[model samples]
Target: MVDLMEHAGANPGRGTYGMAMAASRTVFEARRDCAALLGVKDPRDLFFVSGCTEACNLMLKGLLQPGDRVVVSSMEHNAVTRPLHVLSGRGVRVDFVTADTAGLVDAEAFERAVAEAPTRAIVCQHASNVTGTIQPIGDLADIAHAAGALMLVDGAQGAGHLDVDVAALDVDAYACSGHKALLGPQGIGVLYLRSGLDAMQLVEGGTGASGADEPGQPLDRPERYEAGTPNTPGIAGLGAAARYQSAHGAGIRATERRLTVRLREALSAMDDVVLLGPAPHDESVPVVSFTSPRAEPDRIAFELDRRFGIAVRSGLHCAPWAHRTIGTLDTGALRIGIGHGTTDADIDALLAGLDEVLA
Candidate 1:
């Protein structure tokens, strides 16, 4: 990725020079490889953007129309909900399938929400960013299919941690970040739109190719949605990250699961500590959120970073709906994320640091 950033310096597309061709080839290959990470058959169906937030915006705003009715989960991040909120004011009817206290959105709730018929789309996160509870994506997809609504999954948290085969999940659209668990440079994202879904082109600008052929943007898979020059370095990095995950994703997930159990068990043992989401031993991503009556979430996170050189997140994690669903709207919670580089020693250090901070 760094090499590409340094060498593939020329702008891609509509160029026949050596560096220009190299840059275009880099992006083309990156798109092909990254699409495979999401199990997309055609590489052209995937588009690159700044990050997951942009991808979410494109997916929501470009897909639905004035009279469309969309069903989303209560645990969705502001990325999904905020766009829907804006669309709602314009004529889109937005309905929520509220999650339980465990931050789990059941397919039954989804079925109830979509039962009214004529639903246009069913949108939800693949996993709760705040709680790490994996949502029943396959089951929800089945329900969405039954209702004849398109299934859209926000794959931000679940992309690198789980086997996010968009084909297997049978989702119409998927958006995910390239950083975080994917071990790529930030500021890049992937949006996979199933072929034949004629979503409105939200961002229209120069697409490098065929700019002179037509007055409007090219009516194609990626060029239609992607505007202007893309983040070549970031896309290159994301492609490398996805390729690495494809090789060792299973083992990486197993390691994270074990670390999750270790962290959750220790947190559960402490008095006054309230763990959120699934039980310590349940199936989930390697994310744990907790709050204690005796300490504020912010203070805990601050102390851990300042005193012990440990890092974690506090507050609602940009997912206020999830916090509300999990009964942590007021106090929020401390989130400890176990990632690819995190190790057994790191978990031990975090637990020991928490004990000292509490003391």
Candidate 2:
């Protein structure tokens, strides 16, 4: 990545044939790797963006117009919900399907929500960042298809941790963050659009192709979505990360799940701790959220970091609707995310810290 950046820096003429050809090859390779990570057969179906948030914005703002009704799960991150809010003000009707306290969306309720209106899209998370609950995406996608609505999945948490097959899930589009489960750099993200789906371009600038001369007409799939100078370095790093995951994702997920189970078991055993989201053995990512009756989530997080030298995310996790679904809207839960690098010793250390803090 550094080498690529340095090369680009040395040759600042991005429009030159040599630089343009190099960047184009790098971007295409990165897109192909990202598509492989998402179980997409065609590399052209994928495009790069700033992050999941930008991808969500592109999907919501670019795809749906005024008076279009969209259904979203209650456990959506701010990425999806916030955009929906903005679209609502612009005349798009957004309705939410309720999830249980375990953060699992009710299938019947979701079906009803889709059936209740002429929904244009059904936006749902593959997994909740706050609760680690794995949504029934295939079933939801079936529902969306039945209602004649596009199924857009937010795979921010699910991409690298779970098996994500765009064709098998039959979703119209899938958005994911590179930093989370993909173990990639922070700035890179990926969005997979089913072939032949026309979406309005979110950002427009020099595509370094013939379309740059003609303002309105853009190039094909990825080039249509990616505008301006490409993030070659970030994309290169992301591709490396994706390749690493492709080789070792199963082992990584197994390790994360083992650590998560241990952490959840310890938290659930504590008398003062109230575990939110799915049970420890249930289908979920390696994310765990819990709150203490004796301590505020913020204070617990602070003590864990300051005293135990352990870092964990706290508060609403930018999913207020998830908090509400889990019955923790007033007092948000502390989120403990077990990643690919998390170890059994780390879980033990976290448990020891919690014991001292909650005692």
Candidate 3:
């Protein structure tokens, strides 16, 4: 990979200070490139935040008023739902856009939710954290626009796993974490905002630029949203990660699908094992979730870790609505997420462990 960098325009020898400056610039360009990847035109419209959680809070606080109503799907991550729930405590009216049993947001229902008067914004997750069920963002964006509402999409699980076009989708805001699919370090995230969209700053501090005001925060891209000192190392790594994804993302997507389909087929073949979310798992990412009739989700997770050295996530995944939709509300479901680096051997390891547990 280091040898490949010579041709890629990223030099490791660019000194610590030079590298730091490069990362700052890369962070700016990454926001643009990521926006382009998501189908948004201007890079200046994007903001680099701490992570998806802060991005959600920024949108929620920046867009909504005291009496405004906000709509969110039941399948959204706590990053999206929890912030709105907090706002509801402050007298903001928050309504839910229902999801089907498979954990998908009903497009019509979401549209209707946005149509109601006094609705300030519609927040939706691009995919479910627990079930990996994909939503209809383009159509939902259309509906939200028709209702004069801004659409905020949580892309924590979708940005790297799936294709997104912000301009075509007509979304007002899209938030994503850098670690998950983009393969960057933790504490870095990208938020794409449509031109002319103004989100209130969640915090006010030093942005390292344009701080003549007494309150001390620049009202500009990458500055207005970024307070205090930025994470230069993580941002540099993120630039590398973005370049990696751009070069190999298509192949990664195909590989994840192939592995996920094989694993899903194997899970479906098990007699007592029940697959959760969509059947055939077509529109979702490389996430496969299920429950066993004989065991609890937590025990299943523990057994996989202790007995087979397999790492998988369990519990509600902070998306309670998705767990409820899949009939795993009480116990949640065992989840396996296949990333770009996941291999066939990894899938086989999980399958063999699951089969052993069921037996």
Please provide, for model 1 over 1-359, each residue's C-alpha lDDT reduced to its tens digit, 9 standing for 90 to 100. 77876777778885879888888998898898888877999999999988889889889998999999999999999999899999999999998889999899989988988997589999999988899999999999999999889999898998998888999999999999989787778999989999999888778888887655688778877888888888888888888888898888889999999999888888889987899999999889988999988799999999999998899999999999999898999999999999988998898888888888887
What global local distance difference test value does model 2 have?
A: 0.86
Give the CA lDDT, 0 to 100, for residue 279 in model 1.
92
lDDT of each: 0.89, 0.86, 0.78
TM-score for each prediction? 0.98, 0.96, 0.91
Model 1: how far residue 94 lies from native, Å = 0.6
Residue pairs of candidate 3 with colliding backbone atoms: 38-165, 38-166, 62-200
Candidate 3: minimum summed lDDT over ten consecutive residues — where?
4-13
lDDT by residue (160-217, candidate 3, tens digit) is 8986677777889988888998788799887887777777878787665545465656
User: What does the lDDT come to for candidate 1?
Assistant: 0.89
lDDT of 2 by residue, 142-245 (tens): 99999989999899998998978899999999998988889888898999988998989888876666645685848597778987766677888899888899
User: Candidate 3: misplaced stretches above 4 Å?
Assistant: 1-20, 211-216
What's the lDDT for residue 216 in model 2?
81
Higher-scoring candidate on TM-score, 1 or 2: 1
RMSD (Cα, Å) of candidate 2?
A: 1.7
**Model 1 lDDT, residue 357, Cα:** 81
